[model samples]
Target: MKNNLKKNKEISKEQIKNYFTKSVSNFRNNFIIISLSILKNFRTYVYVILIPIAFLMIYSWYTNAYKGDFKPPELFKYMVIPSFAIIFLVNTTVSEWKNSVFLKRIHSAGISRINFFVSLYIFNFLLGIASFLISVTVMSIISLIYFKPSNGTFFSLLGLLEFNDWVGMLYSLFLCISISVSIGVIISGLINSIALSQSITLIFVLFSIVFSDCFLPIDLLSLSKPLTYMSYFVPHKHSVWVGLISASSQEVSWAFENPERPGRIISFGFNLWIPCVTAFLYSTLLLVSGYFSFGWNTKK
Candidate 1:
């Protein structure tokens, strides 16, 4: 009996080790497949990336031409970065869903749904970061040559910022991308039609742009009580505010408060810990939802 028990324990341990080993190998293979697939269609990425760079350049030119007090490049970074990430991620994910042959091939090769979902998520997140970095680099060059920040303040892209400020900007940017990528996955799983998915994604992007507190503060808008309350659910508001505030060297002129809804307020000054925490929590919730929503039946 003792010998049999010992043998059973050894077998269990071996099985556990093999399970983990196979899972890791599968994950690596899935990641490679996802990377190759995404990179193979690099043209789409190039076009998508160029749109924002062009917009930033033109906006910077206009702001410089008009001598606006706000820095166009820095201000737009919050919206542009997340918008690019969302559009690219959602489109690619939906396209992947539309590719039935590819999904079947991977599944037949022993790639589990979880592995595919996670691999796609990581690859898309990294790609999103790369695209944003490229955009920022180009915008920094434009800012240096054609655009000057108001009052000789430092540029957000390539400026001599303090360590904390850099941390704040990076955190905000990554938070935005994380949230965008997760939501993209969830949307792709929910909407199998590529065109429909892209259309809804575009609508989402437009909504975020119009109401993200970038063009104008949400608190200032004379929205109805329910609409005003719903506006708080928009994750972009917190991320954009954090990024813009961190990037700015001068005092924020607007009062970050809602007169009607006193509870909805981004407190004055650089005390950004709360907003960061809030954004992080929201992203976490989205990620959990994405995990459950991803890997659904594409046929449906």
Candidate 2:
């Protein structure tokens, strides 16, 4: 009996190890397949992402130059970075689910749904980072050549060049992209039509931007109780505020409350860690929800 129990234990251990090994192997194979597909149609993806960003950057530059106000960092944080990120992630997510034939082929090949979902998430996230790097690099070059400092303040360009500020910008970018990709995945899973999914994602992002403190101050939230509650849910508000504050040299508090001066309300300062944690939490929730929401049926 003792010998039999020991043998069973050994068998169980081996089975566990084999399960893990198979999972890793499956993930690696799926990743390669996804990567190759992305490469084959790389131009389609690149054009979809780049055009809007280029347009936005050009508009930003023109407006800034006309007004004699060129702040690369603000332009990046406000418009360019998020434009590329949303376009790339949303389009990628929709494309993955739009074709029924592709889904059936993938399913028939014995690729597990979990593996497919993970591969899609990772691919989109990496694409987001790539788009961000490209956009920032291009914008940096433009700034150095075109932007002139009138008052010896190059906060935007400096933020990109400085080590600490650069890291903070990257950190904020990661969180922002993670949130966007997760939301895209969720939208894709829920909406069957590619057009609908893309539209919804765009609208959602636009709505978030409209409500974000970047456009409307959080203090105004007090005017409407419902708006105040809704403000708590907009991740863009947190993301933009965090990105701006992180890049700024000024000492900014994250907390909105002021104990010493109750009348003096702070909008952006709420402890730097709060947005970071909230973004992660929101992404995880969206990912889990998207995975569960994705239909397993391949037949259309």
Name the top lDDT candidate: 1
Worst lDDT 10-window in candidate 2: 250-259
Over the stretch 135-206, how does candidate 2's per-residue lDDT look in tens digits? 656655555555665623334445344576556656777767777777776677666777776777778776
What TM-score does candidate 1 reach?
0.80
Which regions of candidate 2 are displaced past 4 Å? Answer: 42-44, 47-49, 62-84, 87-98, 150-156, 159-167, 213-229, 250-265, 268-270, 297-300
Instruction: List, residue by residue over 138-210, the lDDT tens digit for candidate 1.
Output: 7556545654454353254335455766677778778777778887877787787777887887788667755
Query: Against the true structure, candidate 1 has what lDDT?
Result: 0.64
TM-score of every candidate relative to the true structure = 0.80, 0.78
The clash count of every prediction, one per candidate, is 0, 6
* Residue 41, model 2: Cα distance from true site in angstroms: 2.4
Compared with the true structure, model 2 gives a TM-score of 0.78
lDDT at 185 for candidate 1?
78
Candidate with the greatest TM-score versus the true structure: 1
